[model samples]
Target: MPVPRNSKTTGSKQLRPGKAGAVENARPEKEESCQAKRSPSSPQGAPKKRSAFGDLTNAHKNQAGLRKKDATKAGPRKAQKGTAALGVLKNNEINLKKATRKTPPDEASAEPKLVPKNDPVLEEPAPVQAPAIEDIDKEQLGDAYASAEYAKEIFNYMKEREEKFLLPNYMEKQYDISRDMRAILVDWMVEVQENFELNHETLYLAVKLVDHYLVEVVSMRDKLQLIGSTAILIASKFEERCPPCVDDFLYICDDAYKREELIAMEMSILRTLKFDINIPIPYRFLRRFAKLLPLPWSQCAHASMETLTLARFICEMTLPEYDYVQESASKLAASCLLLALKMKSLGGWSPTLEYYSGYSSHELHPLVKRLNFLLTYQHDDKLKAVRTKYSHRVFFEVAKSAPMDMLKLEVALKS
Candidate 1:
């Protein structure tokens, strides 16, 4: 059995019935203090002790927050994949743009830029066509030694070079030396060629050097032999494979000039000529014309060689003659060949000769006539070195061959 007591006197302060009911429905104060003590983020002082009820209460609240965040993250799977793919594509596009900015375009693979129609660079000039000439070197095309492919071009270039080196009547410009002295010097140079066994080109170029040097400088008669010997030395160096030494030229000059004098003269001659001693010679032109003849008349090959020798003899005769210094090597060679052909009774200047020599029979008439006159009146004994050289059996005695008659030579030239 339980005893009942009055509410106001139950060993405590009494509250009205409504107030006590409100207190019974409210949260406990101890629970609120425990939560505040566990939380340092609270406005109260530093946390003291953790109560078990406080731990359980915080765990329940954390679980509710986590569930809300999980629901937000549960988006469509396709949308997430699409966003990632779009971001990758944007990065790739940016990288490609950077690469394009760094690398230059390849020339061979790139398109050619279009040139404006009115540009002067686009307006190409027409090529100047060379004249049509006979193909004389066609047979020698297989002979690499012949240089057949560039023969025409080579000769054409030589002809063009002739105009640049035109010699004037420089004899009148000198005071001490005369044309006759010049002739005597040339005669001696021929003897040097024979003695040294030097090439005929060396002799010709030596003579040319003397004449060219005489044109620019005045020399006394005493030093004439020195000048001639030095000229030979210079030409030998230019044209010979095994040119004689400076001592050899001094010995050849009969020790008349000192070694230093000859060397000084050589330097002076080269300086006066500007070191351009590659003057075209008649021998080269004559040989080229001779080649053209044998092709047309292969049967007369032996006779042609003799005739070439005769032509060379005639050409050599004019080297000492001051009157022919102004003559271009090509034209002089052509006239000499014409005279030889006339003397041999070979067909007068054919189309092949005319094309290669660049001289028609009529155009060469005056020079040919003069060349015949030169052979006709060969009475100069002092200048007989060329004649004596060609008269040998080794040269086929072409010098002993008789000259063509005057009237017959005229007829040949006219034809």
Candidate 2:
């Protein structure tokens, strides 16, 4: 309370509760508080959770920006999934998010809501009654066999026409597989089939494309084989996994199918398919429907191979679109095995189809049986001649001549 040096020291510099410097500093703090305390309606920088009725336009935009930030913060994989899901949500008509809101039934409806708790209406619809397979015969299938038979005829004619005339013309037009080089190209295609386990569809498509390219483009002679081999290589890649590498194929051919051949063929074929390698094959569909019917593995494998064999037949033909691979496969399998049965004069139903076929544990499809019989009578010698013409073809080889085991498996399943 006492000034040590002089009383003037205390009076001259008297302290003040509110100094100008303090007031100036306080102004910024007050402004910050006011800024903090403003309106509740103003959106903070934080992202609001997306809701059912959120503004789609703005929501998408904000979500997109947040995604970029999150991607950088989280990782790339999440960002990719988010982007894919975004596309699916925007365009996926069938997979839209389920509506959360549920309406009360009593509010409105033409029909009564709850068939009273104890009423007959409350009873569940009588258990669905599907007839046993024995009761549901092929006659009930109505012309299914006929359709398959007709389809086969069309495909057979198509192959013959495509190969003898159309293929050469196509080669002349598309890839210029000159007459001399055509043989080599054909050989390479066969090699590809053996090497890649490629179905007939891919093989034929590649061959057709190569032929078309040769006919249309006037490439140098030295590069002709390359064009064919490469077409097959890439076609394999598009159609299957574990496709051989350019170098591996080069080695496989003992360097006959060289690197240049592969590279050239890739471009030539890509151009021919118009870059659309998404052509459908029958295997996928056969698997799906076969699951519903319950055919055995022996039958399935036989069916698979037979269907594969049919792909060869179809590849050589031009009657129907290749997109019908599944339909053709199913029919071919049912038919080929059916024929095998008729030749042996096998008969009777199996439990597998005693339910469906009503025959003892032995019969396969009747139509197939009829087809076999008809084929035997119709092509006693013609089969050899047709095979002779198409023997050198890439996708025309028959994998198995007899499918007895598959038939037995089919019969066993019925039991």
Candidate 3:
């Protein structure tokens, strides 16, 4: 009466629960068995074994708790973000308010004001004064003549060289032309000068060239007008910015001479002069002397201009007088300027003028008398060109001014 195999299997399966309970009660014994097995395979100093499943379980629990704490902090973080956005908006509003504030128009347009504590109003800076001529330092004044430097030496040398250009003989004796003929030529040249609006320097230079040519080369009296015309043409080319062409010069001369003859005369004059046309004339020295006068600073420019015009008139008068040819241009200029000042009742020649001009009152007095004689007595019908030219108001009516008396001139010169 043995049991069936199937029944036996079912009975063993039912006893498994009891077996599991017993294994649980024998845990220390199982651990000891496992240690024994591990000890055999491991080295003697190996660490004791840990429960890996227990450590994994504790790590999972800690992770879950940390996730809960992060969820709890999320509300406060959102509140802080909202507050920071509000602060940024408030700062933008403040900036807008500052930008909209009104600025005063005057303050906006004006430069930044620098207000002093004692004086609120801004004062203008005082004007600087020029030094008086008497108090001016010689070195600081930088006057080319007063400095007594190389300019003086060069000028003296030039004076010596210019003296060679003077024509000592009569224009009529040198050439076949009379003094009246020379005066007529000069008068025509003046009209030509006025027509061309040429400078005074050009007029003076033309006259000088004509005189020099007459002295050097003897020409027939019939060709005198051609000589004057050619001299003016040469002078125009030398001095003017837009010089009249040969055709224009011919027209001014009423086409008196042919172009070939005029050209031939120009060549002859230039050849005879050796092209030395740089003759010193009184006009330049007159201008320089007028500027050197120590007039009142306020009136210096106007006074100098008036004096210069009168001096120029006087110099032009000297051009027609053959006797004046012996005097140097510098001496004539000094005398003319001195006479002009005396006539205008300005101070006479001073030491300063003497120092700069290298001529004293005594030296210029005789020349002054000679100039006076020419200005007064030499104005006959034939020699009235310069007087008529200077009588116009454009020349400041210099010819009409009372002639300087001899006694008063002497007194002023001595003073």
- The models' CA-based lDDT, in order, is 0.73, 0.41, 0.66
| Per-residue lDDT over 310-404 for candidate 1, one digit per residue giving the tens place of the 0 to 100 score | 88899999999988999999999999988888888877887778888899888888998999999998569867888988887657788898888
Off by over 4 Å in 3: 1-154
lDDT digits (tens) for residues 228-267 of candidate 3: 8899889877876556778766665655778998898889
Superior by TM-score: candidate 1 or candidate 3? 1
Per-residue lDDT value at 303 in model 3: 62
lDDT of 2 by residue, 330-401 (tens): 344334433433333343233443332222333335534334333334332312322332343232244223
TM-score of 1: 0.66
Residue 295, candidate 2: Cα error in Å is: 4.5
What would the TM-scores of all predictions be? 0.66, 0.35, 0.62
- Would you list the rank order by lDDT, best first? 1, 3, 2
lDDT value for candidate 2?
0.41
Clashes (candidate 1):
0
lDDT of 1 at 68: 91
On TM-score, the leading prediction is: 1
Please identify which of the two predictions, 2 or 3, would achieve the higher TM-score against the true structure.
3
Cα-lDDT of candidate 3: 0.66
